[model samples]
Target: MRPAPLNPLTRAASLRALARTSPATPLDVLVVGGGVTGAGIALDAASRGLSVGIVEAADWATGTSSRSSKLIHGGLRYLEMLDFPLVAEALKERDLLLTRIAPHLVKPVSFILPFENPLADRVYVGSGVTLYDVMSARVGQKRAVPTHRQLGAAQSQERFPGLAAPYGGIEYYDAQVDDARFTQALVRSAVGLGASAANYARVVDYLREDAPAADEAGAAGGGSDGARVTGARIRDEETGAEVSVHAHATILATGVWTGEQQAAADADTGLEVLASKGIHVTVPRDRIDAPARVGVITRTETSVLFIIPWGELWLIGTTDTPWREDVGLPLVTATDIDRVLEGANAVLERPLTREDVVGSFAGLRPLLQPVDGTGDSARVSREHAVLEVAPGLSAIAGGKFTTYRVMAADAVDFAVRSRFPRSRSRTEDLPLLGADGAQLSASRRSLVLANRDLRAHGWDEARLDRLLSRYGGRLADLFALIDAEPALACPLPGAEHCTAAEVVYAVRAEGALHLEDVLHRRLRLEFEVPDRGVAAAEVAARLVAPVLGWDEDRVAEEVARFTSVVDARLRAEAAETDAGAVEAVAAARPGGGQGRRVRRIARM
Candidate 1:
């Protein structure tokens, strides 16, 4: 059978297409949230040959999905918590990503867990890593990641130049990915399979057979009156336009915003999603004495700290604290910054100070509170829960980035349990858009890549290799755009390691509506620059302005809008408390009409 054409997700085209469906011709599934989980659900449902549409209230992956540590791993710390099943599940997904799913996007990364007491700590950590390897091995006959190995003091320091621990470290394997890009790829792939997706489309209320939802009236169980959710009342943030999307079933993958949606819907999902804020700071790669191959992971008093190597920077972070303020508008406050730096400084020969910090971000984990709701955010379970929020509506919250596919499969399974009897998850061996071609044997891939004409673009073999790793089979898609507009191949003046082609691609293909979306999420200039992408914003904005259909005034408006957020975020980072930070960011965030995609399966 001929599959549907992969039409570009230009903002105008998507909005028009998404607004077409009505109650008479409803979709099979309507997914809320364009993060990793919802994206995975879109693909899962489409692969089952069900008609699906996914909507996001903001930009795709602009929430927790984009702000993660970018690790694809079996939580090593979760092992100490004795969550064997969770560790095992995440390990299985990690391998699937490395070997079968997104090898180009998700690659093997080794971490050095430094030990102060060589004897006791080594034995204890070694056993834990050994178990981690065993769990991984059980999932796959061919090992996708390397096993744990003991490193001597000399070897440890050789791998990571700065070693605060006198004793050696345990070298173990995990994986890392560009989480936002990966989530976008899932949406693109799903769209290729005929699923409908739109961003900047927020669900204002739920659609019921009895009556349309009236601003919650009773967000947990009122107005619903045992009625089934027929669909959702969606608001177009850009135009202040509203539309009703009719679907047989609705799945809410709203992450931390799950609570807000539940309250608004008057549906008791039983699953209580508590927002736990985590912060990460970035420093230039040279700022930390760590090598490219070896990242550092150490035990913090409250949580684990990782000094992971990102392109030209070291991403170190993650303070786990309970948050009571906003849902998606998390800020990296002064205290949060200090907590992460102090944690990383404890295991560094030369400590990092506030001056060395370049960029930082914060994410809210939709931590599932225990039935008793007794433990702190750090101790809460990472396992996900699928709840029957109401008849024809399902909600899911809590899960590791590594195990998003599992959560998606479970959510789809629950949502369609009685509705679609023959439909089953077919995403186990499914490769994302770029993975199939990317999985070519290295030697063959190298030989094939060698034939590309890159002289005009000033790209060498190494640069092309990076392109292959980042785009996989989608290299052709990017090149197609460049071919149409030769100037796009030029390097972006301010943004290092990125080309103007990316900005155009983000709009034409990746559904990026504004300059902020390109600079922050698509190009990642925000996390890579000391000025927080402010300097690069103009060039990127100009490049994407035409594609996004912006005039001089619109371009300037976009740049100013982006700058306001960056300026606000910078101010927020200096604030002492979350409240202060919230006040700072909220002041700049414009909402009269503001931000935010999904999709299908080829292999299934």
Candidate 2:
């Protein structure tokens, strides 16, 4: 059976559903993080016919999940590391997502692994890419992308003009997504399947049957009475209110906060995860002079660099290094920017400068640390570990964005398999909210013809195509919003690619609690633009204020708060050192506009 359409992720609906789970009458499963894994878990549990609730500390995908390299390919570098299982597993899931799960959110993208030394480099790299394809072919009923093809030096240069050396290249296929939006889609899909979810809801402490007080180390959830973990004492971060959400089983997919959760749960058993900071910088599409959709993948001394082609800009990234600083403040420094620029310049025909960079971001990967602590994050295992931290509590850590579904299932199997042994995960076959509509509309002409009303409002085929690509089947919802108010059919004030209806849909349908969530995650005006979306922040706030019931002062505060955050990121990006960058963004650490909680919510 096809999954139902999404439910509006309003705070009112989420809280009312959460209020149903009490100590006496607990829900089936409580997923304690709302990142990709947690959201995936909620959907996985719900699809398998279980009552589930997923809560996040901040907005969904505000962690590592949102800040990925935005690639959905098997780890080609892992093949070099001789870890075939990880690559194979990821390839299977990758195809599943591309074909069945999230066809709308994830799309096929091509990359050129350019060769400087055609002799040995071609053989070594070509062999690995061949293996990557074979693994994918063996995974599922249908292949998601085409196999790799080798090109000559001139041929490669003709295909990808940005190649520094025209010694030929291996053209391979992968998929890319708007990471934050993909995470949000996963959430809405889960909600459609009856998973109660809310952002800005933090779990303060675990709710257990019998537990002891803190020790010298301030340990929580410890007891001598054979205590079984029940649920959590959650604090609404938007409001100061607290709630007791009871559950039969609890799963923790908190990513980098795994260690802290271990101590919080007072569990002697679990995974030891380390934080690895990976940063990326984005420049205008014309900077490197690359082809329409073809990107370059070059090997760095430490890790591989991906020059991913996002909508209007080129995303160059990823430096993997040990990070021991605050996880929430994952800001990029001058050194990080310099490293990324240098890595890209090594492959690009034209070098990218600091001024060319429009925006940058950093995400902390939760890697399963080796016992000796090799200090090299690249050497650490990306494979996740799931174990019972307590009787009713289970935690999952490590793994990459590509394999979140497998991780979620593993975590669920550990937490609930023993209790409900017959229950199996059904998410692999479930299409996310927007996927059905995207598949139904084959091309731009079909979509434009279907929504002739958009043409009446001066919306062209390009605008309609963009909407379908972003919202998929959910595009109808936007059309409905535009029909309600013709003004909503217009584009956002500063961010021209986004429509005014998106802001309202973000508030009403998506769970965008603050200005930051809508701009940064929903519209992606934050990292995609040069001004870091500060230009559109005010207009966006104004558009969403009425739906959220914000007064003039509140709208001003939202705009001001988002502007301050943008300024802080700029200061951080300009700072000389990583430590200096951290200090620069000290003021922007997640919780500024919490004085007055949202009182009213727009009905679905």
Q: Which ten residues in a row have the lowest lDDT in candidate 1?
A: 595-604
lDDT, candidate 1, equals 0.78
lDDT per residue (tens digit) for residues 384-478 in model 1: 77776666677788887899999899888777766676778989878888886674566765565456454566665555666777788777777
In candidate 1, how many Å is residue 15 off?
Answer: 4.4
Residue 152 of model 2, lDDT score? 91
TM-score of 1: 0.90
Task: Please give the lDDT score for candidate 2.
Answer: 0.78
Instruction: Give the Å error, residue 231, model 2.
Output: 0.3
Candidate RMSDs in Å, in order, are 5.5, 5.3
Q: Local error of candidate 2 at 569, Å?
A: 0.6
Worst 10 residues of 2 by lDDT: 595-604
